[model samples]
Target: MASTSGSTRPSALIGWRVLALVYDLWPVVAMWMVASLVFTVGYTLSGHASRENIAPFSALQWGLWLVCWLITGAYALLSWRRGGQTLGMRPWRLKVVAADGVSAPGLRALMLRFAVGTASLLLAGSGFWWAWVDRERLTWHDRASGTRMVRLAKR
Candidate 1:
């Protein structure tokens, strides 16, 4: 266990991280639905028939996807910045902090963490798996962003 702020806590393992992500997915999906709805309404108002779905692979469809991604990123960045943990992480007692294990990381580091985490997911979670073998049990994003996730002690 690592000590931080005069308390002993373990670095969050892969299992905890995966569980938190699964929980977080619910809210992200909800955000995606709202973004899709907005895009659909805009598409209809822009001369497309109300009955028509955005054509697959169309530029508009791609833009909608990008918007969804940005919205999800905003949700994560804001949550992490405002508090060390997101809703998902709260149940699991996971908190993100600087590598030194106390201070909140800056926005740049958090953005790096989010981007690298996205890539990790896109790569089928190889970056996350790396934590299993890491000496410090840190994921790629944790290393890249100079941040770490710790499992807080029970209250």
Candidate 2:
């Protein structure tokens, strides 16, 4: 029988994964800012937006947040689907694949990963930190989305 304990899995260390996340966040943040600006501009044109309407529960504020989230998710999902890795992950030789450790994850899985991953970040990064104590070293995002982050051997 094939071993399923992740014994043969070449997972990267949490430290390296953290570093890769840091690197990836640079571009993600830039895109978020641009997206936010565009959303704000468009909303303002709708006549329901205001320069001073920064209230937490304001429709415009919520709209901007949702748009930014979607924009970020699209970037992450497309990147993962295209090559199984992102810009930061490329340097670290890390790849996200299906939880079964066989094929690439599908679009639905990628979307789940992105959504859950964002929640994990918002919750004080407890999700990423979960890898340190997880038996298989899988983060909450990976577990939630049924995905895995594997380390590629240096070629």
- Per-candidate TM-score against the hidden true structure: 0.93, 0.82
The per-model lDDT (C-alpha) reads 0.89, 0.82
lDDT (C-alpha) at residue 1 in model 1:
39
Q: How many backbone clashes does candidate 2 have?
A: 0
Kindly provide the TM-score of model 2 when superposed on the true structure, using C-alpha atoms: 0.82
By lDDT, the best candidate is 1
For model 2, the superposed segments whose C-alpha errors exceed 4 Å read: 1-10, 43-53
Residue 24 C-alpha lDDT in model 2: 87
lDDT of 1 by residue, 90-120 (tens): 9989999998888899999999999999999
Model 1 gets an lDDT of 0.89
TM-score of 1: 0.93
